[model samples]
Target: MNRNTPTSSKPVIAIREADYGRLTALAQVTIDKDLAVGDELMAELERATVIVGEVAACRTIQMGSTTTYKTGTSEPRTVTLVYPGEADIEANRISVLTPIGVALLGLSKGQSISWIARDGTTHTLKVVSVGK
Candidate 1:
C-alpha cells in the first residue's frame, strides 16, 4: 500500500480561495506578533495554492474545522481551529496565529507536519481527520 508521506516532503499546500483574504489578514496578525513563528506563518501563506472553496477537498483543514491530530506518538487530540478572538485553551479552540495553527492551516487528512515549539522543542503533528 502506498501511504502519503509526511508534510515535510510536500512543502506546498492549498487554501480555499474563500479563505484567502481572511487568512491573509490573519497571517498579517501573526507577523505583527513579531514572534519567531510569525515569519514562518507568513511564508506559509505566501506559498499556498489558493483554490475555490466550493471545489476544495472536504478533508482539507481550515478555520472552524474540528480536527483530530496526533503529535508524535501520543494519543490524537481533537481541536477546533478558530480566529484569535475565539481562542480558549480549555475549550480546545486554538487560534490561527499559534504555531500549531500555522502548521495546520491548509493541510489535509493523512498529512503531518514537524515544527519547533515556542520552547524550541521539536514536535510532529499528523492530521488524522478533518470535520466542520
Candidate 2:
C-alpha cells in the first residue's frame, strides 16, 4: 500500500471542517520542531472525514473539548484539549501537538487510537467520554 493509505488497523476519524485549516497550519509548523509527531498529525488529518456545518452537534474530540481516556488497564484520565501555548499539565490541559493529544483528537466516545510515543513505544488510548 501507499504511504498515505489508512490501514484497517487504524480507525477512521472525523474532524470538524472549521478546525481543519488551523490544524493543517499547526501541523506544518510543528514539523520543524518535531518531525515524527508533526508528520503523524498531518497524516491523521489528511485521512479524517471532515464534518461540515454541524460544529455544535459534534461529539468528536476537538480543541477545547474535555476528554476522558484510558490506556492499557489504567484508570481513565480527564483533560481539556488545547493549543500548545495553552497547555498546562497542572491544569489538565493537553496540547494537540503531544502524542496523547493527537491520539485523542477527532475521536468520539468509545473510540480508540494507537500512537507511538516519543520513546518509540507503541500505546493505545481509548476514549471513554467527550464533553464541551
The best candidate by TM-score is 2
The sequence of per-residue lDDT tens digits that candidate 2 reaches over residues 47-93 is: 78888866542688988889899999999999999989999999999
TM-score of each: 0.85, 0.88
How do the residues 1-132 of candidate 1 rate in per-residue lDDT, one tens digit apiece? 101233346556777777778878766776676655567666776777878755474668777888999997799999998888999999999987777887888888888777666676778898999888
TM-score of 1: 0.85
Model 1 CA lDDT for position 11: 53
Clashing pairs in 1: none
